[model samples]
Target: MITINEAYVDSLALNAAAVKNGRDLVKKNKITKRCRTEDKTLLFGDCQGSGKEPYRCSVDYLKPESPVYRCTCPSRQFPCKHILGLLYASAAGQTFSVEAIPQEIAEKRDKADKREEKKKEAIGVGSDEAAVPKRKTNKAALAKKINAQLEGVELLDKLIRQLVQNGVAGIDSKVLKMMDDQAKQLGNFYVPGLQNELRELILLIKENKDSESLYTEAMDQLTYLHALLRKSRDYLTSRKQNPELAMDSESGLEESIGHAWQLSELRDYGRVQAHVELAQLAFRSNLYAARSEYVDEGLWMDLSSGSLYVTRHYRPVKAAKYMKEEDSVFDIVKASELFIYPGELNPRVRWDDGPLRSMQAEDLERIHSYSRSSFTEVIKLVKNQLKNPLSDKHPVVLLRYSEIVVGEDDSYGLLDAQGKQIVLQDTAYLAHATTHLLPLLTPELAANQAMLVLFEHELSSGRLIAQPLSLVTKREIIRFIY
Candidate 1:
């Protein structure tokens, strides 16, 4: 009759530090029955991996003041998976009801009791059975899980090696398709972190232009994958040869410190290709006529190396209110240099136009529509605007701005100026929208040039949308703990 908080379960899922440790034990198969009774205790179960046979380990929560673990398993990793699983179970409100001991075990307990009784009688009635202790028994459940996990690592390693051998462009479509399927399988197994790592590797290779650098990176991933595979194989081999003997060993039941890996470390820049500026300006001139301010910036951070990259995505922000009857400070004038990226925050600018305190009703609508277009669409649209302010239905205008950089291996990432990294590797199709603002970019307005102007028109009114995009850098890579 122990009560567990639901929030604790959520914390367990999100807890970066704890999840790694817990996952390791799960992979090793050292945890079996996680019990949540009056005291959160773990009942040692059969182990199936490498270790001394007949391992004995249990968390005793019978006493809240001083909870302790009773285990014959050796090595000094305290409160191992047996304890962690028990806690997790309790937090999840999973009630533990001790099962009936099997007949054979019951008989053994009875015989032991008789022997202890006889000894107590020989000594004194008050004498206890302290001389006889519970014997350690081989665990069976854990071994099975360990064997399976090892197999998965092996398969993944082989797959990655094969992909690398095939070359970048060659493996691009096929490997990504395979990864998509593999990710689904891994997700079903509750190993999302592992899935993310694999995705990150694929993404890197996909985005790489240099075959040599890609091969090098692929080799590094191969190393890690191989190590994981080896560990799993070792665990499986131990269990198959002498399941009982291995379980009895302390190593069999105890949690192991995983191999040291630098998570979120980014490889060196492989290659860079300059963008081609279009020949003929397809944008209409009227697009920027009632405009105010525009800004777009890109930021990237490599988590492991503490590297950063910043790029810009620029677009004009339309004035809030455009009054057609009055003269305005802002006019249709093309600004230099524009870039675009995925994921950004709103960075809207506002200002006052000539003779008008705010924007007109019609001007506002035009500005709002301008704010909704995606960077690519916005740029082309703006170009059209600069060229012909009056032309409607531009070729690129109706073409749903839904194109993503095809076969991109490396998606953009972000890290704050403080070096905090956030990676967005598995990018799905980012649908075309009016305008989506990224957070990392700097707004185009400066001290001397205030573009976010509001023109007070007799009629038109609307709001302009702004967003900031940050460039990816080496330091913004996120690390994963195994």
Candidate 2:
């Protein structure tokens, strides 16, 4: 059974209104109308704007269910809202008698329960043995995949450019066929995002829809892939190329924390960073903001000794004790491990707020660590920033009352500490979570920790590492005399 909160209900109602609006506009084009509703789920309808038949979809409201409405109305947007309204109506207090779970749903639930049980058992089984290695995708297989993707992307790019050059009327079934094939390839390869964009582009061209928006999005993707090609080549030859090749020309302290400075100007930024990136925290009962200049690209910090320096990614060491054997596959999830980039370059900050939101989850999991009180403190700081967003006085600066100990080689070290060295595992329970650290409670933090660490590949082992250099709180102080 799923519980619905009052706020969620209100949101659904609002969404339903939007869907209703969408339904009205879409129907104006004189397309066929269709409505659908699901038991314990959502409702939606659509009308054709093109010569084709109208598309309609709906999903039932079930626990942990995905988007209910699926449509082929040539819209890249999800749920197409006509469907959302019906679902919202159903959820916003309608009488639909409940019945026993369907056999298929019940069977799915049972299977899920069994899988969870196995995971738990593995966790408790202890480290008498390491689990089997996951299957690796071979290089030949990888090249073939990459090559296919390259072909699809190239074709899409060429199709759009050709459309822009020749005009919409010039488009023929052959061009449409090629675009459709590219879209299908992206979809088959699990790139629904690209697929959706391609669909939207096709519809826009066919209907003479918003030309400007389509052009902008298409260009954005084209530019991103172009840059990715260079980065991919650099990654392939990392051993031979200088480390600086991996870092973009945009690497610098000014660029790294520019967003942080912008945050200080806010009156109430809200947990934008939390919503945007990941952060590691230290537990602190006291409230304060901290600041420090970001020094260099791979400065290694001794978690035990409290020293900082540039270090490579693969400085082979044992896993943290808290790393359950079952969790070993996810190396980044290990708590309080420090790594640094040895080269002058900094890996670009990949933000979820935009396209190419994050790196591999396992990569992120490997660099994870928790603060005893830091997690709570960080969350509070973030929530405050999200809500307040601004202050008249200089933004708050937090300080570390203690040092963060790094777990390594059969031994432990205190990293980049300006205070007493303490073991984080002893102080706080590490969980798979993300956070942000900054000087302002009102302004959003620039970049949270995880990817900040993962972006910088470690040199020695050709693996990944995350290391913290320093902390400080920056504020523009003012004097008011009475």
All models, RMSD in angstroms:
27.2, 20.9
lDDT of 1 at 464: 20
159-237: candidate 1 lDDT, tens digit per residue: 7677667754577676688876875565443233345456666666667647765666566555555554455456556
Q: Work out the TM-score per prediction.
A: 0.24, 0.27
Model 1 segments more than 4 A misplaced: 1-138, 187-197, 207-210, 244-482
lDDT of 2 by residue, 303-383 (tens): 232222221111112321211111001011111212221112222221112111233443223323322224344334434
Best by lDDT: 1
Clashes per prediction?
97, 61
